[model samples]
Target: MKYTEEQLASIRHPRGHSVTFAVAGSGKTQMLVGRVAWLLQQGVAAKHIRLLAFNRSARAQLQDRIRVALPMGAEMPRISTFNSLGHRLCELFEREQQLPRHELSTSEALLKKMARRALVDALAAGNEKGPVSAEMLDDFVAFIGLAKADIEPPDVVLRRLPAGNGRAFFCDAFVRFERNRQERRVRFYDDQVRDPVLLMRAEPATAQRVTNKFDVVIVDEFQDVSRVQLELLVILVGTRAQLNVVGDDSQCIYAWRGARPEFMGRRFDTCFPGATRYTLSRTFRFGHQVSLAAAHLIRHNRHRADTLCISAPSTPNTAISLVKAHNTGQQEAVVEAIAAWCRRNGARRQVAVLARLWAQLMALELALLEHAIPYYKPGPALFDLPELAGLLGYCRLAAGTLFAEPRAREVVRAMLTTPTLFLSANALDNLVEQILSAPEQAGRLIADAAPRKAPNWKREPFYLRAELWRAAQHAWTGKGAADALQVYAVQTGLRKALEGDATDATTEKRLAYETLLHLAQASRATVTEFVAHMDRLRASQRDYQAGSDEILLLTTIHQAKGLEWPCVVLTGLEAGAFPGKRAALEEERRLAYVAMTRGRSQLFLVIPPDAHFQANMEGRPPPLHGKPSVAVSPFLYEACLPASIELGAVLHQCRPEDVGAVRLPAAPASNQALLQRYLRAVASSAESSGAT
Candidate 1:
């Protein structure tokens, strides 16, 4: 954990303002922690320091690091994500101005819905440029978010829009969407920065008060900050507080989300005059092979700083390998390779399978399942689980009915017949049909059809029905969804019913309940708003923790950032798959760089012989008219050539069935041994060339 000279300089740089161009795996977080400690040593009060991270998880990590670095009794600085900070600011502003307190909806789904409604209204008014489908509405909503991030005015956005029939329609829809937000007194996540920046500009005294709230501000992942976010930071610092921004421009992969990497470069200098710049190039995550390959790959980017000064690892091994397979069967080979490595190294928890997209992991997941390999997929949030869907649905129905605005009856029928109730499928279907057939007498019919037997009392479907009805009644009495769920679970032994005997299942059910309770506690709103929030989250498709640590990780490269594995497998290394047909080449290269650098001691890039055919045909062999093969990505060539290696000749080629027989060669036992072997190989190669 010794700090490098560059890292120390970054930590102790002049205090007015500064920017750190920290490369990936360069221990940026460590330096940030060190900077906090250094500031404390220089008589800065921890309570006056503000550290902003990109996400809650990162913020928590920073908080942990800061606490560990400080003396036990030292006060910790305020650390939060930008949105959390905005929420705090909003609260303060509301109290000061006596404005109506409102809730912030960070759900993109809700924003999309609002935008869609506005577009439809515009179309109804005979606007020829209106969006015609839900997909188009989604795109327009995303564009609006990006525009706001860029701090672009509506006229600027209109001018930049492609000359299309929908330009006028979109402009009107955007204005209507803003007006709707004002009427609802709600704020989205982006407005956390947007509104605060607006307020600061409008009220100089308030801005001064805000700036005085902090003595220093440190922002992580500064490369991904949008223009409005930068503006907010500038306003909050306001030539008084020391400002420190840390990020790597080469790692700016969120351009589609309106991240302007240039802000971390020249724009930062312009905003904070006399700001010192520092770069941390020494990486401690990956070994020499990974560092070399990543440096080579990212240097191809058109906009980047100087070449990274990659420090060679003391225990550098032959960590990089190219594995070639024939077709879809290669997934099994990949699984076998993983199993073999796990057996030899006993580090399954430190291994991962990273792909470009989530869909690409389907075959790998199936293979891992077949092999009985423990794996985690980052499932949906607790409320979105299929097992809990019934509970959520029932709560929503009850809440909706209280307002006299229930959803479709079919939805109600589905909720009543959910598999979690353990009702006989045929009987439930019959009951639903009867209910649909006789809507007026549905309640009476349900009571009449309810089973009367109690032989297996707890397991009886009648008992489940009664419990759900009871929960619904409680919900109707104004109990929140979380409370109602807890009541139902306890009253009917629902947890025991769902858990059965499996320990993992029992643990998952318990965690789901705990998660529900936590969500309920965090939301201070009414039952209806809570239910609506849960519904919107379910619709958003965001991944949540699977609550298991002893499992192999399967995730996209994007999700694998800030994480490292001892053994890493990069799948689908073909042109169309890795680079993707629609993505910019530079972005794809950065992705490859990120993937390569994730490995600490081992890196395997798998290239299927028919990659093109598999990608085109969805992991199946080519159809009758499909192309026969795929070319290896140019990145592979770029990395392999300069490393003085003939990848194709040296790579181990095997079929799915032969994977068990293809073993990795034993590496040198010690760093000195490995360095000696490398030197000998170089000398021998030179001798052979001289003889030729």
Candidate 2:
């Protein structure tokens, strides 16, 4: 891993406050690691150097890289996520001040629920000016989160409440939330960062003492740093410690999560006067064709820096395709075509499918699964599975003492009618109806409705029902929700029932159970908190599986960041889909740029042939009754690339003369206009010669 000249310059830049604008796939992490090694070689102690990463995975990678860079017996620098660093600072402050430790709420959803209820109560008392809706509640909560990240005070938030109907309600709720948090000595996850900043501001001596502990501070992914995070860095560095920040502004896509890419621009120089700026523009991940396409697409963004540094061209006329599929059958046909291409090129593990949204990938996922394609979604957590909904519902019911609520009734009904339960449907329905009718006596009714013995080799449903009831009672008394769920799962033999068949369903259920066990081992929450966490997990549609790297990847463009594949399939490249009707045009263009850049050697952009063509459902094709109205994304035209072709003409048994002629958009008269035209001619020649 020899360093490029640009990377070496970034690593060895005069040591003061500096910012590095690292482009996508430009070895940012490698350069950062090199800089840390340089600092160590300059006599900076490992203990005095701190590195911050955006996530645990990134932190782990940094740690590994630093270890490799250091001598065999040398010590490693402190590397951690911002949240972890904040937690460490808070703990040290608490110990020094002799203050009691306060429990932090791990679940943001729990805090949101509390805030929503407070707003509802305030609105009921006529404190609000207009009607309150769920969307309003969600928006108010998000606003508060962002405000805290920006270090805004309650009065400032009240003054800036977006001039909406729930303004008064949001203000009231915000004030009440502050008061309640102070009273209970409870903090939200954001407070891990916020409280430390407050503590440092109120105690300059403490802040100075902490600053003395670090000689250099390096922040990765600085483009996504929120205002408060920047403030924390400033306080910690204290004009003495060397500060090095690295990130790419064009890759900053987390605006919804309080990220402010502007901070990575001129604000860096403002924060640290005379700070040097460096750019790592050379990308080693993709070839010239992919780079040119990405460069042209991102040229539309007004805020980005100059064009990316291009590498020398290789394999002249890179393989790029534009496929048109009309219906579900055609969509499946496209998948089959991809499979054929994979087999011919031996690129099964090097391919990925990137979509604009998760919903759009559902049908593709199903089609791949039906075709026995090995696919992997990196983080499909157990809680996101519909199969585990019943189990989670039962856990919630177990945590609640009363069984009269509608939620409790629904959980019981689902449990009784579960396929693994082997209970008669009519009997379960009658039992549920009785319990619903007599809400107050729901517990007694459930116990009485338990069926007798079933003529099977295994234990009966009656015994399982009794075990579940006992587990619920125990959970209500003292045991946590996680504990109760574990007990119920074991006693009911759910894992055994799900494991008998060696099929995909069995594999999924077993993996889900393993995830549940992992959760149980990690959780320290009480029953109520556990239930709330579970609720939050259910609301979030993240999923995870082991060995994901060995399968085909299907994910959103957002998730596709920081990743690359040899062959990439960009799906749903139509108007109102890729640009997305509600998204900012520049941001959407950046997204398209990101998707295009992920491909190393080959890229395929899939387009619907007609307005009626949709891939929204499983096994359902586009309606067969409409004229062709769907057009390729404006981005394809905007890129001015000429490698596009219809998929129908390029399938496995197709003749070279059947290749659909590509309609190249007129090249824009920008810096790359001439290059685009030259590339178009090359692609035209290649296509006519039957080159993929």
Candidate 3:
């Protein structure tokens, strides 16, 4: 647990204001823990220190490390994700503020529902430019999130947009949405994070409570902060409390939520005067080859801070190789390379297959299924799909009508939170409370809750109420469960909803309906038994996650951040695939840099035959095109891997039988078995291993 000199310099610096520029795999986490321990040694109270992580996963990791680093029976400093801290503060003062407690926690869909209502009001008031549909509201929602994150007012953002962007109507609606939120005390994820910044600026008393709560504030992943987050940090660091930010400017790849790398470097200096800067220059994660490749690619990005990081001395000088499939062999080549890696190295070494889009993973998924190679992907479970979950929800509600199964409040909450209905938080609570208040009148609640013709002023309430009633009636049929589901989908307009809702591809849309029908075939038993079977299937996924130690991580590049593996197979490296259509080239290069550095031992790049083929074709691809479809990524050239690199022999040569031959991971060892292994090793060393 010894710290490097570079890390020690930052941890032991005199407490005022400082920024630790930590590169990838530079062990900044341990340095953060060390800074806390140093504060304790400087006679600072643990209660006066606050550790803020950017996300829940980072918070959990920091908490685990704190326990390992600090002494037992010691008081720990307060640790929380930024939003969770906001949630805690809201919980404490909400009663006094007269906030809508249940409605405070919202979702993206419901937020758009709010925006959709605001847009309609704007249109009626003669404020909008032209007609707009629900499909186009994605931009409206995204604009609101980005504006809130940047602390930009509607007028300011409106001035920045082009004249003919077709989104001028949203500016007026934005103002109306804020008015609605402030009047009702309702907020979504972005609003929740910005609440503290707004509240502290508005009320001096609230600011005093927050400022007095901590003496020293340290933020992890500070490079990923939005403008509002930077403002919140400034408030906490207001001329008194010591503050430290630890992050890498080069690895700031999250531009979607208003994060740019320059904020951690130049912005740090501008915002906090005379803040000391420290850098962690040695990465112990990947070897020399990966370090060089990542450095080469990221330097192309115009916005990064100029800092040098070297590979560890103990790290190997591994060669980052390439795999080019001439035609229909992209999936087959990838699977072969993956299996070859597992065989050459130990199976226990983790390998990650990363891509730019989910569509890319679809092609790779078919390869795994063909070979029956077990892999893991952190995606939506089959039963958790909206259409599927709705059917289950109906079945559960239907079964409830037959018996007194949901006498408990939690069971009712479960039914209310299902995928089909997206109600305003306040309206949902009112329905649930009524059921609890009048247990005897529960049967009539769904049927009588919504009126025939809903009011025109507000949205979500009417639709939710009406849909719940109709769904309940349709599911309550005396027919079999599958037949009831079919009736429910038709009567409740679920099919129509899916068709119009934001489906990316027609194939995916058809897939959901096909899955619905397939699920219906299994719903032959009563609705209650079918629900239990679905629950059991979900439970088995957890066991499947623990199925093998040699698990293949199938995930997107965005999800692969803040994580590393021994071997990495990056697929779909074609021109239009990795750079994507909407992303800027510089930002795309940063993303590619992040993916390259995620390896410890090997980095294998794959150029599929064609981006169009992999995305458009779901099955075995046809022969290679005359000119070989789309070229390999321009970023691959940045890594010194050109599109015309010599084709390796075994890249497309591995047989499917060899892939299927690798065994599943063995079960864990028992106590006696472990003891015998230990005894055998000790006996060979000329010692009495164990008692006879």
- Please write out the lDDT profile of model 3 over residues 328-348, one tens digit for every residue: 233677788889888888673
> Relative to the unseen true structure, what is the C-alpha lDDT of residue 230 in candidate 3, on a scale of 0 to 100?
85
Per-model TM-score versus the true fold: 0.65, 0.66, 0.66
lDDT of 2 by residue, 1-692 (tens): 56766677889977788888887777788899889888888888888888898889989988897888788989888888989888877788778863347777787777876776667667767643333443355667776777677676755655543343436556667777767777778877777788888777776776876664578899998988887888888887886688998988777776545675578876676787777888876666655556556666777778766646343222223366666753122356568767876887775778888876654454455455445566766544333443454555566655663364345665666555332544333556677778657744555655565443424343355556655665565545456656766766676676666555433234334434544444555566656666666655433322323334456777889898888887888886766456765456776787788888787667887776644333211124556675556556778766645422221112212333432343333333473453544344334322211111
| CA deviation > 4 Å runs, candidate 2 | 98-100, 125-141, 153-171, 202-205, 307-309, 312-318, 326-330, 378-550, 610-631, 643-666, 670-692
lDDT of candidate 1 at residue 35, scale 0 to 100 = 92
- For residue 285, give model 1's deviation from the true position in Å: 1.0
Candidate scoring better on TM-score of 1 and 3: 3
User: Candidate 3, after superposition: displacement of residue 335 in Å?
Assistant: 0.5
Per-residue error (Å), model 2, residue 655: 31
lDDT of each: 0.64, 0.64, 0.64
